[model samples]
Target: MEARLIPIALTIAGSDSGGGAGIQADLKAFSALGVYGASVITALTAQNTRAVTMVEPASCAMIAAQMQAVFDDLEIRAVKLGMLGDAQAIATVAAGLRGRDVPVVLDPVMVAKSGDRLLPTDALTALRTELLPLATVLTPNLPEAADLLDTAPACDEDRILEQGQALCELGAQAVLMKGGHGRGPECVDLLIRANGVTRLSAPRRATQNTHGTGCTLSAAIAAGLAQGMDLTQAVTRAHAYLQGAIAHADGLGVGSGHGPVHHFHGIWPNG
Candidate 1:
């Protein structure tokens, strides 16, 4: 019998005890998308659908050791970055990724779905300075984009593109400006690269169970990249996958406040 190889993606992020976002969501997305997942937990959050009550960041040494441990043996084809807790953690991750040749999906996860602060306001500068320059894809929602730029969220298409350009100028190889927080019947996501910007829009889904959306999307993209998809191809597939997940989120009946999307919606019948 011949040996079989599997595409593997790495996730460096926090852990949500709620099992909705962070490392749990990332691993689920990877598995759902047919990629093997490895994780390095940077922080641990006491959170559920309703709120984030407490957070504990891992030590810098442990973070570095985990990254080394993963890269040393595993054939990590892509990386999905989520909630890096502090400036030191960001620096540690950036240092670890400085010379890697894998595709990197940086989610810039600043806040939770419940409006709780995940990354401190003081850590934004560190993230922008160290990580953005090395990111293969930077996925930021309206508020996250605004936080990165230290400005107000864009209310229209033109401003959104303008901010997207501003982020590109800041060193993100490509920016996927997410519009989940925008108003209207349709949600727009712009894939802004050096060549041009491609628009991907889908009708706004009316699901209160949209927790961990950003993490899932980026992780799906990493999974696609691990499976050898281009940026546009991966983003397109991830966008559609997220739509399906959100569309069927309410079926799960997970929590009371905001619930989680079904990462296995495609695999399971009627989720």
Candidate 2:
């Protein structure tokens, strides 16, 4: 009898010591979706829900080595990029994954919930020129989109669609414009691809546990893609998973600041 094969997803991102966002969140999301998760840390931050005090980036050589090691062994079906510290790291990641035939989900993680900048301001250009073109799906919140576009993000539906289109024009095969930062009764996420734009809407849940929402959503999407779902199906599953996680995020008692969503909300006890 042949042994069963598991879908593998790789997350190339920074490490959150607090275990809320970045690699920790990505791995949790992958596991919840039944995907085997691998990681290549680009940086390490002394961070918690409250603030990020210090950050130390890994050498480009080390980053490349980690990625090579993973790709050499495991059959990675999807990749997620998150919280790359600088232009050099971004370039390293792009070079490492340039020819890989896998869906790449790029989460433009800029600022932490505690108001600390994750990606340096100087690295924005590298993200645009080097990384954007390589992404299969670019996931950015309203503020992130604004930063990338160097313009005010639209709040209304019309403007949001325009922004989504604009992001797609930046060279990503698809763009998922997250609307949690936008003002509305419902959170509307726009997925723009070559085919068309898709609107995924969910009721806004009043919760402070949104620390790792972006990372988790992107990771979940990667997991879905690794599991052989189409782009639309993957996005839909990810949206549903995020909604449930946010809704069930009541009292984990993690930290004083913005807490983390229940990553394993689907399988947790009494979830």
lDDT of 1 at 6: 94
lDDT of each: 0.95, 0.92
lDDT accuracy of residue 264 in candidate 2 = 83
Measured against the true structure, the TM-scores of the candidates, in listed sequence, are: 0.99, 0.98
Cα lDDT of model 2 by residue, 1-271, tens digit = 9989999999999999999999999999999999999999999999988889999999999999999999999999999999999999999999999988899999999999888989878999999999999999999998898889888977788887788788788898999999999876889999998898899999988888888999999999999999999999999999999999888777577898888888987787532
Highest-scoring model, lDDT: 1
lDDT of 1 by residue, 1-271 (tens): 9978999999999999999999999999999999999999999899999999999999999999999999999999999999999999999999999988999999999989999988889999999999999999999999999999999999999999999999999999999999999999999999999999999999998888999999999999999999999999999999999999999898899989899999999888763
Total clashing pairs for each candidate: 0, 0
Screening candidate 2 with a backbone cut-off below 3 angstroms (N, C-alpha, C), the clashing residue pairs are: none
Model 1, runs deviating above 4 Å: none
